[model samples]
Target chain A: MIKIETCLTPEILHLHQLEGKIAVVTDVLRATSCMVAGLNAGVKSVIPVKKVEEALTYAAKGYVTAGERGGVKVEEFTIGNSPYEHMEEAYHGKSICMTTTNGTVAIDAARKSADQVVIGALLNVSSIGRYIKEQQKDVIIICAGWKGNPSLEDTLFAGALVDQLKEEVEITDDATYMALSQYQSAKNNLSEVIQNHASHAKRLSGLKAQNDLAFCATEDYCDVLPILNGDEITIK
Target chain B: MIKIETCLTPEILHLHQLEGKIAVVTDVLRATSCMVAGLNAGVKSVIPVKKVEEALTYAAKGYVTAGERGGVKVEEFTIGNSPYEHMEEAYHGKSICMTTTNGTVAIDAARKSADQVVIGALLNVSSIGRYIKEQQKDVIIICAGWKGNPSLEDTLFAGALVDQLKEEVEITDDATYMALSQYQSAKNNLSEVIQNHASHAKRLSGLKAQNDLAFCATEDYCDVLPILNGDEITIK
Candidate 1:
C-alpha cells in the first residue's frame, strides 16, 4: 500500500520512522524554491550546506555561494536567496553552494536515514508528487519550518501534493488528512491564503521580500525534480 | 499580550518554548474528556499516571484505575476510556487514577516545566477559553496525539478554541492561524469534519468505540476547567 504521512516540521522528523520511505523536504518560502529554480535553470547541481562557513568553503572551491540567514543575504555569498537570482543566465551551468536558515538543516537530518530524499516546493510540487506516485514508495513529507516551528507555506505545499496523489495513495496518519483538508480548503485562493495568513509571508513583507513570496506562491512554476545525491541535489 | 499557539503533538512539545506559558493540553478523543467529565461530575480529583503499573499502584491504594491502550480498556482496569464511565456516581467524591496511550504522557511532559498545565476537551473548550483569557497568560495548546504524531481531533479542538480566543489574543505563530482557519472552515459541520476525517475516529470505529467517539465529538457539553494541581486534576 502507498501510505502517505507528513512531518509538519523538521523538529519532529526524528520521531518519524523513515527507513523505507521516500522523504520530500519542503522549505517553500525560499530555500527549496531557490534550489528547484536553480536546477531547472540548468545549474550543474545545488549543494546544500548546513553552515555558512561550509558554504564559504564551497565558494573557495569555485562554486557560487548562495546563502541567507534571517531573511537577509549572507555577507560573503555571491547570491542571496531570491529565486530570480537562480533563474539568471549567469547561474546556468554553475554549481551553487546554498544554505538557508531552515531548509539545509532539514535536508541534513533527512539525509541520515531516508531511503531517498528529494527537495520540494511550490515550484515543483506537481512533478515531485508524480515522482513519488511512480516510485510507489511510502511517502513522508518533511516540512523545513522556520527554526523548528511549522510555517504555513510548507504544510500547505504538503497538502497540495497530497491532493495530487491522494486518489492513488492512502493517508497513513491524521496529519496527512489535515494537510489535504487544508489544501482542499485553500487551493482556490492560495496567493491570498499565504500572503495574508502565513507568518513567514507577514515576516517577509516586513523585510520587503514580496517578490520572493510571489514567486514561491506560484504553483507548478518549475518542473525539475531535484533528488539528493550525497549532500548535493541534481535534477533527475 | 495573550498569545496563542499549538503543539500539534507531544512529539513536537520540546520545540515549543513553554517556560512561562499556560499549557492547555487536549486529547479530545477521550482522556481529557474523561478528566473534564470526572471533575464536572464532582469527583474529588483525577490523577493522570504515565504507566499502567503506576495506575495499578493507585488502584491498590483504593483509587479507581481507568486506563486504555490502543483504543480499548486496560485489562486490569475497572473502566474503559468512556467519559460516561467517569461521570458515574461511583467515581464521585473519589480520586480516579487514569492512564491513556497519549494524553497522560503529554500531561507528564507539560507538568515538568510549564508554568501552568490544564486539561481541555470539546466538552469544556468554552470554559477553558474563558479561563485562559481571565488568567491573561500566553497560551500553548498541546495535542496529545496517538503516540507522538498529530491527530485531527485534537488539532480541530485547538482550532475551535483559537477561534474563540483570537479576538482577544494575538496568535504568536502560523500554526495557530492555521488551526483557527481550519476551525472556522470546519465548525459549520464539526461532527462531519471530525468523524469523516480524523484517523482516530476511523480507528475507534474499527474497534467499536463509536460511543466514545460520539461522546468525545460533542462540544461544550460540560463546564469543568480541569486544571492540574501538582499531579492531579481538580476543577477550578
Candidate 2:
C-alpha cells in the first residue's frame, strides 16, 4: 500500500509521521523554483539555511548568498529569489547559500523526519515526479505555504505532481484529492487561473513580481531535481 | 478589516489568531448538518460534548443523547449522527447531548478563543452567510476534517460559504482563496464533485450511509443556523 499524503502548510508537518518517507518540499511561488533552477543552470550546489545570518556566514566566505525575507532581496545579499536571476551563466559551477521565508523553513522541518527531502516546484515537476516513482517509497508532498497558511501556487503544484503519480500510488487523504482537483481545474489556464485569486500571487504582484510569477508557472521548464543531502541541495 | 480565513483542519486551529473573531465550525458530512437539522426541527438546544461520558451524563438526566463515535451510533444512544433521525417531532423542544469524532472537538476548541462560534454546514449555508454578514465582524471558517487531516467535503462547504461572503470581507490568507476556487469549480455539481473524491463520503457509503450522504449534500435543505453559546448549540 503506497500512501501519498500532503502537508498543505509547514505548520501541520509535525502532525504527520514522515519518518522513512520521501518528502517533497514545494514552495512554488519561487523558493523551490529558484533552487531547482540553480541546480538546472549548473550551480555546484545550493545550501539551504533557515536564518539570514546563517546565509551571511557563507557570503562572508567567497560563496555567493541568495535569499529573500518578504519576497524581496535580503540586505547585503548578492541575489534575490528570482528564478531568472539563478538561470544566468555566471552562477554555473558556483555554490550559493540560500534562505527564504517559507521554503527553507519547510525544508529544515522535513529534514528532521524524512529519510529523503527534495525541492519540488512547477519548474521541475516532471523531474521530481519521475524521481519519486523510481524510489517506490511512500511520499509526502509538503507545501511551504505563506507563514502557516496555504498558498494556491504550492497546492496547485502538488496537485500537478499528484496528477502525475496518482495511477502509481494510493492517495490516502482527502487533502491530496482536493489539491489534485484544484490542479486539474487550474491546469488549463495556469497564469489566469492562479493569478486572479492566489493571495501570494496578489502579494507578489503588489511587489512587482509579474516576471517571476510567469516564470514559475511554466510547467516542466527545467529538468533539475534538487535533492537534499544534509543541509545542502544538489542535483541528482 | 472584516477578515475571513479558514482552518483546513482542526490541527491548524492554533495557527490562526481567532480571538475576537466569529468562528463558524463546519463538519458537512454529518455533525454540523445533523445539528443544523436538529435546530431546524425545533429542538430547544443541542449541547456539543467532546466525549461519550460527557454525553452519557446528559443522557442520565433524561435528555435525548444522540451521536456517533466511529461513524456509527454509540451503544445505548437513542439515535445516531444522521440528520434525518433528528428531524422528528419527538426531538422538538428537547435539548439533545451530541458528540462526534471531529465536529464537537472543533467547536470545543473554537469556543476557547472565538468571540462567537456557530455551526455552519451545507444545510445552513444561506442562513450562516446571512448571520455572518449581519455580525459584520472578522470570520474564521473551521473545517472539521476527518481526524486531523483535511477533508474534501468540509473544505468544499467552506469554499461555498467563502463564495457567498468573499465580496463583503477581506480574505486575509491563501487557504481561503483555495477554498473559494474549489467552490467555484465544484459548486455546479456539488454532490457529484464531492462524492467523487471525499474520503469520509466513501467511508460512510461503505457503512450504508448513502441516504445520509445525499441528505447532507443538498443545499439549503435546512434553514436553521445553530449558534454555539458556550458549549450548547442553539439558534440565535
Candidate 3:
C-alpha cells in the first residue's frame, strides 16, 4: 500500500517524488473547485497560469479567460475563478485559461510528481476516488494550502480523501490523522467545521466565495474526473 | 501586544531573524526537556557545544558530559539526553556539558532574532509564558521542530503556549488557531490527546524516555526558566 499523507505546510511537500503517482491536487477555496466546475460545465481543458499576464496571453489567443485576483474576478474574462461562475452555459465546450492566488501554484507543484494529475474537491470526490483506485499506484492527495501555508480547507479535503481511501493506503503523520479527524467531524457540515480557520473566514468575507466554502465542503457533487493530459486537461 | 507566533516548519522559520529575540530553544524528544529536567533537578548549567570536541573540552573542566547519537546516548558521557536520568537528586547543583540532535540548531537559529533567548517545554510553560509576557515584546515561540521539519510535539507545545497567551497576543495564521484548537481538544488529558499523534507513539515505542513524555506533559512542573544569556545559556 502507498503512503497517503497530508502536508499542512506546502514547503514540506516533497515536490520531486510526485512522478508516476496519481496526484489529486486540492485547493478548496476556489482553484480546484472552480477547475472541477469548469470541467463539469464541459470545458475541454484548463491551463493554470500563475501570473495574469500569462492568462492574458492565453486570453488573447481566443482561449476562454478565467481567474481571481484579490478575491475579485479579473475583468474582460469569460469567467472568474469562482466555481459558481463556471455554471453558466457560455463556459461549456471551451478551453479555460485560468490564474489563481494559490491553486495554480499547487497544480504546478503536482504536475511534476504526477504522471497524471487530477483536480479533486468536495465537488468531485467520488470521481477522484474512483480514478485513484483505477490507477493502482501511490496516490498523493496534494492539498494546495493558502499562500504556501497550511489552510484548513485543503487539509480538510485531504482528510476527506483519506476517509474515502483508508483501507487501501498506508497513512503517514499526525497531519493525516488530524485532517481525517477534522474531515469526519465536518463531514456533516464544513461551514461549522471551518469557522475558526483564518483563511476560511477571510474567504467568507470576500466576494462571490461565501457558499464556496459549503460548496467545496459537500462531497461527491459530480461523478466527473479531471485528468491532466500532456498540457491539456481532460474530464472523463 | 506582541505578535507571538509558532512557526511550525523549519525552512519557513526565518533563520536570519534569530539575532534579536529572547529565544527559547526546545527539542522535546530529549534535548530541551532533558535540559530543563537537569536544571530543575539541580544541575547548575549545561554548556552546550555544537561539536563533540567542544563538549569534550568543556568535559575537561569537571563537567558531567552528556549527548546522544542515533537516538542512543553516547557511552563516553556520564549522562545522556534523558530527562528522567537528569531528574535524580544527584544531578542538582552539578553543571553539565551537553549536546544533542536539533535543539542546538534551533538555539543557533534563535540567536539571530534578537537579544533575549529562553528554553520552553510543558515542564516550565507558565514560567516561560510569564517571562515572555513580562518582556513585553514580539514573542516568537520557536518550536525546535525535528531537523527543520514539522514535529508533532514541538507544534503541540507551540499550540499550548498560544492557548495560554492568545488573549494577550495576536496570532496570524490558520496554523496557530489549528494547533490551539487541537490542544484545546486534548488539554484535559494530554496522553490521550498525544496518543493520536505519530511521533509520540514512535518515541514511546522503545526508549526509557517514555515516562519523560508524561513528565514533560504535566503543566507547570518546573519553575526554572532556561534562557540564552549570551554565547552560553543559563537559568534566569
Candidate 2, residue A149: lDDT: 77
State the DockQ, from 0 to 1, for candidate 3.
Answer: 0.46
- List the DockQ of the predictions in order: 0.71, 0.72, 0.46
DockQ, 0 to 1 scale, candidate 2: 0.72
Query: Which residue pairs clash in candidate 2?
Result: none
Clashes per candidate, residues 3 or more apart or on different chains: 0, 0, 22
**What is each predicted model's overall lDDT from 0 to 1?**
0.88, 0.88, 0.73
Q: By how many angstroms RMSD does model 1 differ from the true structure?
A: 1.8
CA deviation > 4 Å runs, candidate 2: A205-208, B205-208
Q: Write the per-residue lDDT of candidate 2 for residues B25-120, one digit (tens) a residue.
A: 999989999899888988889998999999999999999999998798999887989888888899999998999999989999999989999999
- Model with the higher DockQ, candidate 2 or 3: 2
lDDT of 1 by residue, A1-236 (tens): 68999988887787789899899999998999999988898888999989999998898998899979998899999999888898789989988999999999999989899999999998898999889878999999999988888888999999999999988888878878888888888999888888888888877764448878888988999788999998779999
Candidate 1 structure quality by residue, lDDT tens digits, B175-221: 78878778888888887878888888887765347767777888899
Ranking by DockQ: 2, 1, 3
Off by over 4 Å in 1: A206-208, B206-208
Candidate 1 lDDT score at position B69: 94
Instruction: List, residue by residue over A93-140, the lDDT tens digit for candidate 2.
Output: 999899999999999999998989988999889998899888899999
In angstroms, the error of model 1 at A170 is: 0.5
lDDT of 3 by residue, B16-131 (tens): 25444555556766678888878887778877766677778877777788887655677778888778887778768877777776776676666765577788887787788788
